[model samples]
Target: MSARKVGMMTEDELIHVIRAAVREEFSAAGMRVDAPADVDEARRDFMFLRRLRGWVDGTASKIGGAIILAVVSGIVWLIVVGAQAFFNKP
Candidate 1:
């Protein structure tokens, strides 16, 4: 294997190399890798917002579903108990 000296690289070159390596790693993990020029500040901000919105939507739906289920079960139990009491009257 050939060896290169890290100290010989300029700061910018070292940074670029590290960035490329990290990008490759994420790409290998099946993520869509956008070119650096394609991802401006606006794109980054939108990505963050989109992810946050998705999280909030998923959590809210789960909570709402649980609340609906509890309310329905409570209503059913009350109806059943009221019917039994009325029928069992002496």
Candidate 2:
């Protein structure tokens, strides 16, 4: 789905879409997806693998953000060091 379409959906609709997509993905992977009737029910369960895909997806975004920040910071540092060297030269 497009980001614009998802952005226009209500909270409940978005939840349903996301849940269905996750179920489809799990089914494709040959994993048994036993989704609860509602998200609250899923949260109540104590299964280790439940919501693992969501956890991994969130973690991957966080890692990507961190890498982007690090790369930008390095570029900024190089620019600053080069500026200082140019200013200090005879």
- Model 2 worst lDDT window (10 residues): 37-46
lDDT of 1 at 6: 49
The digit string of per-residue lDDT tens for model 2 on 1-90 reads 556532477989989988889988866866545744444444555354557767999999999999999999999999999999999999
Please give the lDDT score at residue 73 for candidate 2: 100
Every candidate's CA RMSD: 5.7, 12.4
Q: For each predicted model, how many residue pairs clash, with residues at least 3 apart or on different chains?
A: 0, 0
The candidate scoring highest on TM-score is 1
Which residue ranges in model 2 land beyond 4 Å of their true spot? 1-50
Model 2 residue 1 lDDT?
50
